[model samples]
Target: MPDPTFAGRTVVVTGAGTGIGRATALAFAGQGATTVVVCGRRKERLEEVAAEHPAIVPVVADVATATGARALADEVRARGEGLDVLVHNAGVFRFSPLAALAPDTVREVLDTNLLGPLLVTGELLPALLARRGNIVLVSSRAGHNPGPGSSVYAASKAGVHSLTRSWAAELAVHGVRVNAVAPGYVRTEAYRANGMTDRQVEGLFDAVAGSVPLGRVADTDDITPWITRLADPAASLVTGQVITVDGGMDTGAGQTDQDA
Candidate 1:
């Protein structure tokens, strides 16, 4: 049987060139979305994703910039297809202490992870309202859990959680639900852009895997199902929530006394 939850809907996924974003676009397409607009800064990567599914349409744009964000909205509106599901997944992460990060780097993180969502949502609000659609913000466990050398990234995600609740409250009357999906340490190419060497990234993943009760890091697929479910009509009553898919790492399921 076909899962036609979005058979005729239009879904937009930012940072869809790779990792969670790529997986998410594929999920919506698999669910039968008419058009899954996959946005990212890399044309080649976005094209690759589009090649995997006919429903996926690649649009290279930097959601972090207001101009880029508006351009994307224009493209979507030009198609005359109302937006049904908007997923804010374009984020940048640099694992460094506040002092070590350049002023511009901090701004980059905040712009992409925080302001980008706001800009895109504001641009697409009318379409979302028209369809009574939902928004899914891709946040991180760092929003609640503050590990060392990640203050900027964590703060950006914490802001995402705040936006989830704020937008949910503001859009409820209009029938547009807002929520977030906070993923744990997932093994993705995202780390490759995080300024970590191959060996260091592998070592970090190894250490974090031990803390998870499930005894492993997450893959992109591990986080995709919740995203699709949240946007589906089956979860109509679910809003203003942050669903943490972290393999029980944040739940302390396997933490001993000293670890706690």
Candidate 2:
């Protein structure tokens, strides 16, 4: 299944140090992308990803800040290749009730999850237009299904969904498609960093699996293909769509675990 559609194309994947971002970088490389820039704050993690694939060129940048996003775009421009695909996958997840949430924390979450993508995409618009590239934004299920202790995170992702639509409409004439993939409860380090013990994490997954129509949670690999597909040239007519890949968590459209 080696697709040469992206053989000589340049792709940039933000937040590609680990989790879904890392998976996506590898997926694009595997599909024949020549230059895959992995941008993130952690140089060490990016280095590890580079070790896994030679096509992965690690660029340490914090997408949450305007300066960092611009710097990353400049780095891509320095490479002298027009951007073929830009995947906004860098994100932060923090859970706190609205009462206990600090103003600074709220700003940080929104800046990282919402504004960062917008800034980076805006900076790279010229390059994308030159190549008629598309954009793939990594959103979350919380954006649509906001529950307890997820106010800030949910709000940020909801903004992302709106941006997806706005950018899609604006970029259509330029031949750039914009779309998002909203995932629910994928197994990633973010959960551990959010103060959940391994046991607690497992229990949470089991509970969610029991509640969701699907019997299990998702892995990073489970999500990479769909995101890559949207960026693929084959999906030329697809735009302004938020594809939900939550193992039927958002919609109870699958058979429940009890049914199994």
Candidate 3:
């Protein structure tokens, strides 16, 4: 049976063009959310996802700017008085060693992964508070484990994790829940498109799987249901928590030792 926990909720999922964002938007629609606003820079992809799910609304905007965030807020306000869930899933990633990383790339990553959410969340805070809503930040295990060539991405997500905690505390009295989902090596098209050679990708996955107790990379579908659950009112008391859905990669034996 489909969960009806979100029957009357309206969810906003940024980065809904593809990957985890697409999966999460679909999941919320399947759970009967009244409205699912899918935001992304690509209007075509966002509209495609919306077409697949009639319940979803496509909002094509570069959420990396304050003006874009305000426009999204205005759009949502036009539909209703407030929103019940805000999923800050819009993000970008690039692989570059510290020496090879361009300043623009670092700034872009930080803007999209960190400041973009801050802008959107700030604009939507009043509405969320009015509805006693929930906020879910899509973070990464990179935040917890800073590896070589991921300094900027890791730092950006680490900032997100910190924001999750701070927002949880700040929004608590107002009854708005703030939490984060830290995903480990999930099999997304974006990951596949990374510059790694096939052998390198396979080796990375193999090493990750072997280290994780579950011994597998996560599928996009595998992570969406949890996101839906957290957005539900049933998770009313859950706040300020960064739940890692990393196939035990963040926890199992040798995980800490290997990284150290």
* lDDT values for all models: 0.89, 0.88, 0.85
RMSD score of candidate 2 (Å): 3.1
Which candidate number would show the highest TM-score if scored against the true structure?
Answer: 1
lDDT of 2 at 202: 86
- What TM-score, computed on C-alpha atoms, does each candidate reach? 0.95, 0.95, 0.92
lDDT tens digits, residues 57-130, model 1?
99888998888888789878998888999999999888777568889888999999999999999899998998
Q: Estimate the overall C-alpha local distance difference test score of candidate 1.
A: 0.89
Query: Which 10 consecutive residues of model 1 have the lowest summed lDDT?
Result: 251-260
Write model 3 residue lDDT over 20-139, tens digit each, in one string: 999999999988888998888888998889998888999887788988898888878888758999999988878868889999999899999999999999889888988999999999
Q: How many residue pairs clash in all the candidates, one count each? A: 0, 0, 0
Of the candidates shown, which would achieve the greatest lDDT relative to the real structure?
1
Q: Which one wins by lDDT: 2 or 3?
A: 2
Ranking by TM-score: 1, 2, 3
> Model 2: which residue pairs collide?
none
Against the true structure, candidate 3 has what lDDT? 0.85
